[model samples]
Target chain A: MKAEAFLQCSQCKKILFSVEFEQLLRVCPHCGHHHRLLAKQRITATFDPESFEELDKEISSLDPLEFPDYEEKLEAAQAKNGATDSVISGWAKLDGMKVSAAVADFSFMGGSMGSVAGEKITRTLERAADAHCPAIIFCASGGARMQEGLLSLMQMAKTTAAVQRCRENGVPYISVFTDPTMAGVLASYASIADIILAEPGALIGFAGARVSKQAGVSKAPSDFQTAEWVLQNGMIDKIVHRREMRTTLTNLVKMLSWRLVKHG
Target chain B: MAKTWKEWERPLIEVEENIEKLKQKAKASPEAEREDLLKRVAEFERRRDNYIEVMYSRLGPWEKVLVARADQRPYTLDYINSIFTNFTELEGDRRFGADHAIIGGPAYLDGEPVMVIGHQKGRNITERQYRNFAMAKPEGYRKAIRLMEMADRFGLPLISFVDTPAADPSVESESRGISEAIAASMLKMFELEVPSVSIVIGEGGSGGAIGIACASSVLMLEHAIYSVIPPEGCAAILWRMPDKGAQAATALKLTAAWAKEFGLIDEIVAEPKGGAHRDAIEAAGLAKEAIVRHLKLLKKKSGSKLKQERYEKFRKMGRFLSENPVDALAKTR
Candidate 1:
C-alpha cells in the first residue's frame, strides 16, 4: 500500500499518502494537524486487509419523537457517510489478532450519539464478549442527539451497562477518542475504558469549552480540555496521533490477544 | 497575588479605612474640622453600603460565575458527611480502579438506610489536582452505577449531591469509556426501583451532573446553576467567542430560579444571606431536612411506584397547556 494516499488536514490543507500517513499514525508530518478519518478508512488502517466482519449493519433509526426534519437529516447523513447510523461496528484483525471495533462518524450530525448508535455499540460489545474478543471503540461525537430528546440521553446509560457486562466477562474494552467528543457521550461510557487513547488535538469533554465559558467559568487554559489537558489531569492513558494509531492498536491488540489466548 | 484585595473589595476597604481615620480625627481635632470629617465619614459609609447592596442585588452572570467558583462555598462531600450518618464508602467499578471525584457509600438518613453519593471538590490547588477538579473519570460513574445498583438491591433509597462542572474530558477518560460510564449510570438510575433524590449544590453543568441525578425528586440550591451546556460552551457555538459566556448564561437559563420556573427542578433550597458559604452548617441542615422529609415520604411508596412517579415527573416537565377553555379542551377532547 502506498503511504501517501490519504486525506489532507482541513486546516493545513496537506495531502497525505495513506501508507505514509498510517506510519505517521494519521498526523500530518508537515503541519501536525489531525485529520478526520471515515469509519471504513479507520477499519482498513487498523486491521489486517479483508479481516473486517461488520455487525448490526441492518439496524436503522426510528424517529420516535417525530422531531421536525429529523428523517431528512438522518437520510442526508446516512447518504453522506454511507452508514446506517452515526457509528459503525464490526470484528476485525489488528496485526492478525481478532478484536471488535466501533467507530463514530462525525459527518453524521456531528457524530451525535442517538438510540441506534448506542444500540449498535451495545451489540458490538456483546458480540465481542461472546466471541471472547477485546472491544475497541473509536468515539467521535457531539454528545447526545437532541433530536432524539431524552432517548438519546438514555443511550449513555444503556451503553455503560453493556461495557460493564463486557468487563465482567473479562473482555478488555478500549476507548479511542477522536476530535470533538462532548456532552452526554463524554459523560457516560467514554470515560470508563480500561484503556483510553486519543488523537492529538481531539476536543474531549462532557461539555465543550464554550459551554464552560458560558457558564461563567474562566476560559480553559490554552491547552484546556484537549487530549493533552486530559492527560495532564490523568483522565486518559495516552494521546496517540492519527498516524501512529494503526501501529499502536496493532501492538495493543497483539498484547491483549496473547493474554486472552494464554488464559484460555 | 494573595496580597491585594480584589477590585470590588478595594473600594470597600478604602472606604472603611477612611471612616476609621475620620473618627480618630474627629476625636483628636477641633470642633469645626471634626464636623466636616464626620460628614465625610458618613458619606463614605453610605457609599460603601450602597455599593455592597447594589453589587449583591444585581450580580451579572459573570459575577455569578465568580460566586459559584468561590472556594469558600461548601462542596458536596462536606455536606454529605455533616448531614448523613454512617456513610460506609463503596469503592471501585469492580472492573476498573475507583475514581476519587465521586464519593458514594451506604448511610442512614434519620435512622433509615440510604445511599449517599456526591461530587467532592478539593479545597485547595493540591486537592483540586487530586480530585481532578471534581470531574468524574469513567470509573467515577462506573462506581456510582455499582453503588446505586447495590442500593436498589438492598432496598435503600439514594441521595445524590451534585457539584461538579462536568465529567473529566481527558484522553484517558475517553479511552476508558467515560461516555459509557455516564450512560450506564443514567440508565441504572432511571431503572432502579428504589427511591432516588438529588440536590444541585453547585454547578450542575452537563451529563456529568445528570448521570447521578435521574431521581424521583430533585432540589437545587438558590444560587447553583444547571444547564444542558455551560454558558461558555453556548457562547463559543453561538457567538464564535468563548468570552461571550455572560450572554450565553442569559440565554441558557441555568440559574436555580430559572430551573424552578422551567419546572426542571422540583424546589429551590434557600441559601443564607450571602450564599451557602456564609453558613455551611445551616445550609447543610436545611438540605438535610428537605432530603429527610422527601425520603421519608418516598420510602412509603413501592419501588415501581417511585419509578413511575419519577418517569412521569420528567415526562410532564416542559409541557405547556393554555388556560383558555377551548385550547385546554381541544387536546383532551
Candidate 2:
C-alpha cells in the first residue's frame, strides 16, 4: 500500500481505513493511541464551529543561515501542509467562550519552531492579552528548526517572553502537549503555562528519546518521558484524553477568565 | 589531553613536542654552550606563546567550541568562590529530591547580597557523574525556580552562570519533567521583581543554557559558545554526519561575536590573553565587574518596568522579511 492509502497504528500495528481514522480524530480505536495531527485538524477539534479567526498568516521564516536546500525543503513542507509554517494561530471560541489559540502541526516539518513559527505564537498570546482572555496553545513539535540555526533557538526566549507578557497582563495561558513535544518548545513555552495539559502517551521532554539515550551514560526506564510518567511526576496539571480535551480546555478557560475579571 | 583536544589539537601538539625535544637536547650539551642553549630555550618559549596566540586568534568556530568545552575551564562553582563571599547554598526543589547538577543560594557579591544560581560541572570522573557534567535534571530547574521565587520575595538581585553542554537529556530527566521545570523557571524569572544577570561562562548549549538565562542582561565570555544545539549534535542531525561538526559550527553562528552582533546577547566579557582556563581568578574578576555593572543599572528601574523591558528585549529579536512575498501574502489570505 502507498504511505497515505491506509492507516496503521505505529504502536499497535493495526491497519484501519483512512475515513475511520479521521472520524476517530486520528486516535487508534484498537490501542487508543493518539496519532499526531495537523494544525488545521487540531483547530477543528478544539474550537467552536465557524469561530476561528486566523492571524499573523503573512509571516514566514527567512533562511538566515542559508542552510543547504532549506528553501526547497520549506517550499515542499508548505505545499504539503497548505500553510506558511508549522504553527496555525488565531482567535477562536472554546465552548462559545472567546479565546486565542495556536496549534503546531507535526506534519509540517515535524512541527519545528523557526522565526515565523515563534512570531506567530508570540503574536497570538499578545492578541489574547489584548482581548483580556485566556490563551491555549496545542504543542506537537520536534523542537526548534535546525535549518534556522540560532534563529530557531532564539524562539525559546522569544516565545517564553511572550507568555510572560500575556500572564503579566492578567491573561491566563494554557499549554496542551500532544504526541512528541520535545526540545526548545517544551523547555520554553509548552511547559510554562499557568495550566499544562497533555494527551495520553504523548512523548514530552527536552531531548528526543533516542538522542538522549545516545548522549547519556545510563539507560532510561521503559515509561520515561511519556505523558503518564510526567503526570505521575507532578509536572503537568492533568492528562486529558482526545475526547475530553475540548471540554477540559473550555472549563479551564472559563474558570481562569472568570478569576482574571474578578481579581483585576 | 581530553578526548576532544586529542582529536582536534594533534597537529599543534606535535609541533610543541618537537620544540620540547630540541630544548632538552640543548640542555644536555657541553657546559660551553649551556648559556647559549638556555637563551635559545627562552626564545623558543616566547615563540611558542606567540604561536599559541596566533592559533587562538585564527581558531575556527569548531575550535572555539572545543575551547569552551575544555576540561580545564573553570565551572560555575569556581567563579562563585572567587567572585562572591559568604555563600550559603540551599538545596532541593521541595517537590522531588535535590539535583546536584545545579547549585544556588544566597551570597555576597562585593559585599552586596545577591542570589547566585548556576550549572555545576565536576573536574573528575566520579564528580562528573555526580554532577551529570553540569547538565541539570528536572529537580535542578525546579530548585532554580524556588530560589528565584525567594530572590523575588527578599528583593535580592539574581545572577546565573551558564556552562553546560546541554540540559540533562537522559530519560530520567525527561520522565521527571525537565521540560516543565525549565519553562517554569523561565516564567518565574520574568515574574521576579529583582535585578538579574546571566553569563555564559563556557558552553551555553540550548534549552539547558536558556533555562536559567532569562535575565535582564545576558553576557557571554569571548571564548564561550551559545547555540540552540551543540555543534556536534547539530551536524549529526542536519548533515547526518557527526564529523562535519566544524562546518555546522560555522553555520550555527554560536560564537559570542555573532550573538552580540545579532543582539542575542547584551554584552561580551573579554577573557584573559589565553582563555578563562588560563586564569580563572582573573576571569571571575571580569565577570564580577560585568554583573555588578548590569545589576546597578537595573536596580534603579521599578520591577514592572524591568519585567516589561526584558519581555520587549526578547520579543524584538530575529525579525526578517519573507523572500517569497507572493506566497507569504497568499498565506495571509
Candidate 3:
C-alpha cells in the first residue's frame, strides 16, 4: 500500500500533496486558507536562501516552577520537533535587506512563550539593535506557557521592554501576526510594532473564543477576532497574503531603514 | 472570593466574638464586675492586634495570595478617594461604549494634576457582576488608552491601581479586540512623556494587570500578589488539578517581597496590620506617600528621558546565570 504522502486542509478539507503544499507555502490552493507553518518553514519562506544566521541556539526553558511532567514534555517536544523551543530567533535577509528575524513554531507546544522563548526573542532584538539593523518577528502562539507559571508570563513584559529599546534606538521592529496570536503575546510585544501586519483570517484576540462564549459576556459580530475584522476595526496595519508577505515586508524595510539612515 | 476572614482566622475572630459576648454579659452584670470585664476585653483586643502583626510578618506565599484577593481589601477607588483630591472622572473609549471595569480620569495627586486609571472590583455580588469582577473588557483598555493619550497631551503624571484576576475572558471582550486594545495601551504608556507610576493594590493577574502597570515606578502593597496568571489557573495547567494552587502560588513568588527582591517592582508599600483590609486609610496613606516620592523623582526628568528610563528599567528584569551553558550546547549536539 502507498504511504499517505498527502494531507488534508483543516479549514477547506481539500486533500493536497505535501510537496505541492510546501511549494505553495502551506496556503490552501482551492480555498486560499492560510495554514500554520513550522518555524523553519516560516523562516525559509520569509527570508532569502542561506541568509539566516541563528542566534541563542543554546537557550532552552528550565523547569523554574518544577512542574510535574514539564521537563519530560520539553524533551519530547525537542525530539519530535527538532527545535530547541517554540521560537527560532536569528538574523536573516528579506529581499537582500538585512533584518533580525524570529519566527514561532506552532508545532512546538502550541508555540507558547516561556522564559527561554521570550529571552531568545529579546536577545534577537538586542542583537539587531547592536548590529544596527531592523527587526521583524512572526508571532504564532497560544499565549504564555502555563507550566512555567508567572515566569512564563513575565515574558510579556520582557519582550515589550525589548521592543521599547528597539523603538528608543530608532530601530524598525515589524511584527507579523499569523494563524493564532492571542493572550500575552498579543497583549505585549507582538501588538506594539512600528508596523503591525496579519495574515488572512488569523485568530487574533486576548481571550479564547470558547472561554468567552462559556462566560455569557455579550454578543460579538460574526467575524469577531478574525484578522479582517480586526483590520476593519483599525487595530492592524494591513492584511498580506502568504505569497506577497516577503515582498511587502521587504518594501516596508526599505522605507523604514531610510528613516534610520537619515536620523543616524 | 467572599469576606471569609472570620472563618480563616478562627482563633483571632473567636477572641473578638468572645469579647462581644462578654460586653453583653457586662451590660447585665453588676456595676462592680463591669469594670474588670471591660479591662479584660481591652487586653484581648491588644493581643489580637499583636497576633495580626506577627502573622502578617510571617505569612506564607499562599496566604499572601489570599490576602491579595480578599474582597474587603481597599480597591482602586478606595485608594483614589484617600490619595487624590478633586478627581474628575472621564469615561468611554470614544470609539465604543463605556466599560465600567476600569475607571480613569484627570485628578490631583498631592495637589499636582495627574491622570489616574485602575481596575475596580465591587463590594457585593451585584456590583461584582456589574463591574465584571474587576476584569477589564476591550473597551476598558481602550478607555485607558484614550486617557493615557490625554495625559500625555497635558503632561499630567499617570497613576494606575491594579487589582484583577485577569482581563475579562468573555467572548464579547475578544470580539471587540481586547488584545489590540491592551497592546495599544502599553504602547501608548511607553510613548507618554509624562511621569507614570503603578500601584498593585490587590490581585495583579496577567496581561490585564500589566496593561496598566507598565510604569517608571511600579509599587505593590505588602500583601498584594502580582502574577502572569492566577495560581489556580497555573495549578490547573501544571498539576492538572485545581487543588495544587497553594503550591503553584509559592512557586510563582507572587508576593510583594519576592517581586521587590527580584526587581520586578520598585517598592513595597506597607499594609496595616492584618493586611490592607484591616486598615484602608493607613494603606492608602502609605500608597500616597510612595507615589508622591516616586513622582517627585520622575518629575525631574524630561519626557524623552522618562520614556527611555522606563524602557531600560523593564529591560533589566529577569536576568539569570545558568549553572551550565555547556549542557545546553551539548543537548543540541
Each model's DockQ score: 0.10, 0.57, 0.46
- Tell me how far the alpha carbon of residue B302 in candidate 1 is from the true structure, in angstroms, after superposition: 0.6
Model 1 chain B worst lDDT window (10 residues): B1-10
- C-alpha RMSD for every candidate: 10.5, 3.8, 3.9
Off by over 4 Å in 3: A1-4, A8-15, A28-33, A126-133, A165-172, A219-224, A228-234, A255-264, B1-6, B319-333
Model 3 lDDT tens row, A97-165: 789899998899989998778888888888777777899999999998877666666677778777767
lDDT of model 1 at position B267:
86
- lDDT by residue (A88-137, candidate 1, tens digit) is 98888877778888988888888888767877787788787788888999
iRMSD values, candidates in order: 9.4, 2.4, 2.8
For each candidate in turn, the TM-score is: 0.58, 0.90, 0.89
Candidate 2, backbone clash total: 0
Q: Model 1 in CAPRI terms: which quality?
A: incorrect
Which regions of candidate 2 deviate over 4 angstroms?
A: A1-17, A214-221, A259-264, B1-3, B6-32, B322-333
Q: Evaluate candidate 2 and give its CAPRI docking class based on DockQ.
A: medium
Where is model 1 more than 4 Å wrong at Cα? A1-141, A144-183, A186-264, B1-57, B316-333
Arrange candidates by DockQ, descending. 2, 3, 1
Per-residue lDDT for A119-175 in model 2, tens only?
Answer: 889888888888788899999999998887777778888888788778778899999
The whole-model lDDT of each prediction reads 0.75, 0.85, 0.84
**Candidates sorted by lDDT, best first:** 2, 3, 1
